[model samples]
Target: MQILLISCTQTIAVLYRHVLEDSYCLFCSISKQRFTCLMSRKTAEVTL
Candidate 1:
């Protein structure tokens, strides 16, 4: 019973870690796109 519990716990931990990593990656990508957009706008303003 203890072994089974330990395995289950480990599986849950792995799943949670995977979910967190995926969310973090998504956030990074969104922020990167926003950053690029902001930079481009700034360059356009300077050029004008």
Candidate 2:
């Protein structure tokens, strides 16, 4: 059970890293409006 849990956690971490990389690449390719929208979302998160 402990080994299964460890592998599951590792898989989740790898998936999260891949998602972050993809999102960053997409963000870089987005236009000004999209960039501002993303910035606003980030600021909202910071406020929370």
TM-scores of the models, in the order given: 0.20, 0.20
Where in model 2 is the C-alpha error above 4 Å? 1-8, 18-48
What Cα-based lDDT does every candidate model obtain?
0.23, 0.25
TM-score result, candidate 1: 0.20
lDDT of 2 by residue, 1-48 (tens): 111111223333334443333232212222322211122123111110
Candidate 1 least-lDDT 10 residues:
39-48
Error of 2 at 32 (Å): 30
How well is each residue in 1-48 modelled by candidate 1, as lDDT tens digits? 111111123333334443333221111111221211122122111110
What TM-score does model 2 achieve against the real structure? 0.20
